[model samples]
Structures are given as C-alpha cells and as structure tokens.
Target: MGASQAGGLPVSLKLPGIVLGVGLGGFVDGILLHQLLQWHHMLTGTDSDNIGVKYYSPYTVPGLEMNTVWDGIFHTVCWLAVLCGLALLYGRLAHNRRRAWTSRVLWGWILVGWGLFNLVEGVIDHHLLAIHHVRGGPYRLWWDLGFLLLGALLVAGGHLLQRSGEPLRPRDADDEGGLR
Candidate 1:
C-alpha cells in the first residue's frame, strides 16, 4: 500500500522508527532487568533444564563478570542498531523533501518496533533458547508470558494509533524563518 494508506507515514520514516524502537527497547531490557534489578543476565537461564552445558551465573562473581561481558556485547549491538536507524532517518529526511518527524505515525511505528523486539526477544531468550527469564523462580513462566502479553498490547495499541494518525503537512516558505 501507499504511504498515506499505510498509516500516513512513508516506509522511509517507519523503518527508522522501528529500528530506533528496537534499539531503545533493548536498552531498557538490558539496563532495567540485567543491571538495575539484578534479576537475570544473558546466560542466566542457560542449561537450567539440563539441556546443555551451563555457562554463567547471576549470583557469583565470575559468573556475573561473564554475564556482564555478554551484556556489554548486547548493548553494543543495540547501540549499533540505533546508529543505523539514525543514519536511515537522516538519509530519508535529507532526500525525501517531507516532514515526518512531527507525525504520530512515527511514534506508532516506534511502539510497533518495540513490541516486535519484546516478542522476538521474549520468545528466543525466555522460551526457545532458555537463556533467561524476566525474573527467575518458580513463577518464571508467568513472567515470560506477561512479557509477551505486554508486547501484544503494544503492537495492537500502535496499530490503532497509526491508523488514527493524520497526514504530514507541507512546509510553507514563510514558516521557515526563525524569530527576528
């Protein structure tokens, strides 16, 4: 579908919004859960079910160190994604001759991107890979399920917001100048 029909924002803008959302979402997950809360790490749930060899721990000094390193790597990847998004946004804005930054469409796409991140990460880390959980304990499954639910909510909310967004207004020549 065309940009206007798709959600009032072009794919050029939507792509960057999603990329930024994923990057920022990753930061939130890493910072809040991994460091601040001390709940889980990249390898916290590894081999918890005896599926494979265990690697690290969240409670021990060495294990924490290793996990910290892995977390750093994860953060680096997130940072790179953010940079890529920024680059894409810059390229689009510079060449498209359209103003997309001030639209709700961008925000909606961002939410969708974050939801996508949560769904993929939650499934991969919490379920399929057994790398870690939102919070470790007997109730881990519940926490993981809750995370997925939140993701679904975000996606739905974003979709609604996107549909409700208006088209971007063209820039007027007289409105370009700053206050005298």
Candidate 2:
C-alpha cells in the first residue's frame, strides 16, 4: 500500500525487492550454469539435445559466437532490471532508508521476485519455447522440474517471511519516547 496506490498506505519495498531479486537470479543462472559449467547457452536447445547428440547450438564456431552474443543481450536485460529496482527503492524510502535496507519485508519480496523469474523463465524457455534447458540429457525433464520446485519453495518461503514485516517509518515515528 502507498499514497499513490489505490488505498492510503505507505509504500512497501515489494517492487524494488522483486526487481533486484529477478536480476540477481538471472546473474546466478548465467554465471554458474551458462558460463562456468557450460551447461547450456541462449539458443542451445534442439531436438538433437533431446537425443543426447549434443548439437551445441549450430555445432560450429559461428554458432558459439552467436550464442555468446545472445548471452550478452540477456545479461544486459538483467542489468537493466537491477537499475530499475534501485530507482524504485529510492523513490519508496522516506527517512528510513537504512532500516528499509535491512528490513525483512524487502528481502522477502526480493526472494519472491527471484522465484518468479525462475518460474517464468523455466516455464517459457525450458518447456514452452524449447530454446534451452538447465541441462541436456535424458534427465533434462527432471532438472527442469527441479528448477520449478526450487522456484515454488522460494516463493512460499518469501511470502511467509513478508507476512511478518511491518511498514517502514522514520526513527521514533511510532515511539513517543525517542530514547531512554
């Protein structure tokens, strides 16, 4: 709830948190699975991968280069997400910036955002579009399912944590006695 929102309430950290989380989660997947482990690339998925032939995108140097370029584009989008999140966060803070940074509500929303990214990405990229996968093999379906499961868990956990948080406020805003 926020003043600009439909009802009268202070702004929550949900938007920024989710944006940051989605960006962070993308970074993790790109760095760990795509670059470091060489599990897959932007356009690596093909029917050949399903049969374990390991087509490697187009199976040539040019294809690898193209995949690399696509990966760069993906990274750029993720970077933009992070920037957008920061801007939203700055707008939300009144005089409790420090406390908001450490608030459970913010972090919880971030977790939810990350989970949402995983769910949406996994569903669209891995299953619907067939562009790529967590990995290529007979067990690819299992890996994809596991990714979705992890996303669900994060969402559930984040929701639970967010339920316990209060709205942000300036120091002593709610306390009549500032200090003892």
Candidate 3:
C-alpha cells in the first residue's frame, strides 16, 4: 500500500516495467560503451574499423538488421525476478513482506546479470577484436570486470535497501530510497 504507483496502473504492469528497465539499461550500455566510449560494436563479428560495418550500425532499425537474442534473454530474466518480487509483495499467495531467502536470491541473480553483462561485453569488445581497452591500460579487461563487480554490489545494495522497507514504485521521489 505504501508503494506509490499511478492511480490506474495494475500490478501486472510491473513486469513490463522491469523488462523496459533492463532493456533500456542495455541500450544505455551499448550507446555509452559502443558508441560514445568507442569500445566495441553491437556485434563483435566484424572489426569496428571495417569499412562496410563501421558506418553501418547493425543493431539499429533498418540499414543494419540484427538479432537481440541475448538482450531478450536477460530482460526475460529480469522480468521474472521483478514479477516474483511483485508477487511476494502483493500477490495472494505471498506474504505482505518479502522473505529473507527470496531477497538474498534476488540479489544473487542481480550479480549474475552483472557478471553476464561483463563477460559478454568483455569477450566481444576487449578480447576478441582488441578494440579500445576497458580503461586504457595493460589490464583494462580486469578494470572492466571490476566495474561489473561494482555494479553487482550496487544492485545487491539496492535490493537490500528495498527489503528493509523501501517502496518499489517508480514515480515516487523521496519515498524511494534506492535505485529504481
């Protein structure tokens, strides 16, 4: 009840919100690392400097068609976790409060997502094509891994705070103590 959602949106809509959050997070990662930072292309099959592929963004809409199987998979997982959280928080079968083990497990999965993001990004961008290093160093790959680890920690911290009684609603500002 404390969760401050819009007046008309149903609880079922939380799943889509979770999916969108995860997917948009991926989009930001791709844009920042691949486009801004110039780390790697969407698909690592070809070199970034390749004439044919360089100018063409494979993951974009028309000029370059692509597959987002991996992104979809991760988003699906995030949606499931978010659904579970919603269920535990509001569903008939669940208690009003989240269970301890459930929160811990969710935190663990967050770590998994972070690791997966790092592995896929690292293998494709750093190791395979040797584009830009993670942070421009001899062991830039390790640096990138460390960043992933930090993100995992942040997710875990966020979940822990949520479990401590913070609301899950997106629209609320002050009442929401941690990450959205």
The per-candidate count of clashes, in order, stands at 0, 0, 0
Q: Give lDDT tens digits, candidate 1, residues 82-169.
A: 8987887665552223446555777787788788889999998888888888998899999999999988888888777766776443
lDDT of 2 by residue, 14-123 (tens): 88999988998898888888899988887789554333433445468988988888889989999999999988998776554677777788889988988998999999
Residue 104 in candidate 2, Cα distance off native in Å: 0.6
* Greater-TM-score candidate between 1 and 3: 1
Candidate 3 accuracy as TM-score: 0.38
CA lDDT of each prediction against the hidden true structure: 0.76, 0.79, 0.44
Q: State which candidate, 1 or 2, has the greater lDDT.
A: 2
* RMSD (Å) of each candidate, 1 decimal: 5.0, 4.6, 10.8
Ten-residue stretch with the least lDDT total in model 3: 92-101
- Candidate 3 structure lDDT: 0.44
C-alpha lDDT (0 to 100) for residue 175 of candidate 2: 56
Ranking by lDDT: 2, 1, 3
Best by lDDT: 2
On a 0 to 100 scale, what is the lDDT of residue 137 in model 2? 86
Error of model 3, residue 147, in angstroms: 3.5
Better of 2 and 3 by lDDT: 2
TM-score of decoy 2: 0.83
